[model samples]
Target: MVVFDRADDTLRHLARYWGTFRQMGDPKRSPAIAALEAVLYEGRAARIHVIYDGPTTVGGRLIPGAREQFSTGILARASAGTWQRLAPKADPAPKSSPLPGRVHVVQDGDTHPAQAVLMTDAEVADWLTATAAGET
Candidate 1:
């Protein structure tokens, strides 16, 4: 299970590996493969999780109840009875003055909340994706 301090980072990593699962061609019989696509296209700003078992050709399968947590805007999957439990660590910084209609951009790998930036949603997403891909 991998946890990201920022949602965008999670999405970027997921998108990069999405193609690997698409070749499988079916989700119902392959929950793990299907889940990857589902999360990449439908996931939102919430905790995102993914699970992968060995290739179905190798006799692996996704487990049930793998998508139960953070369902409203999160994604999860499991295979071979194993699931990745990726979750963000809670930020520990003290809150600052409340800004009306402001969006907070949390830093990826930020162990403390104080390091996060106050930016637009798009900026946050871009930062996450770029960071996940090992870009500056």
Candidate 2:
């Protein structure tokens, strides 16, 4: 299973979804999303989960249909935060199995430096695909 972190931008980049135009700027599939979806289509990923910070409120007014956009495996901000906190920490350099159901954050200069995989989107995608296929 692959769990994306701070995936608001990724959700916004869904090519099929256009409701998030203003906030997201463009309704095109991001490179990362595209690569992942390709892998999914090719029957590579066993399970895919995208968790984002969602259901945002501005000036105490809830955004219409914000929660509805996230129909698949989307957790509310509070719930996701709690899950993240409760989730087990991943060692930066594991001696044995590299990915034993652990979170590998895809980002540059992550706040939690220890758990982050500091790599470009394409690099991360390639690594994930190779690992999933037991090619790495």
Considering every candidate listed, which one attains the maximal TM-score?
Answer: 2
Candidate 1 local lDDT, 1-136, one digit each (tens): 3333443444344444654565655433444345654563445434455333222112222223333333222212322132122223323332443544332222342322223246888998999899999999
Which pairs of residues collide in model 1? Answer: none
lDDT of 2 by residue, 27-67 (tens): 34345444544443433344444344432322222233332
Which pairs clash in model 2? none
For all candidates in order, the CA lDDT equals 0.39, 0.39
Q: Which ten residues in a row have the lowest lDDT in candidate 1?
A: 74-83
Worst 10 residues of 2 by lDDT: 69-78
TM-score for each candidate, following the candidate numbering: 0.20, 0.26
Candidate 1 segments exceeding 4 Å error: 1-3, 28-136
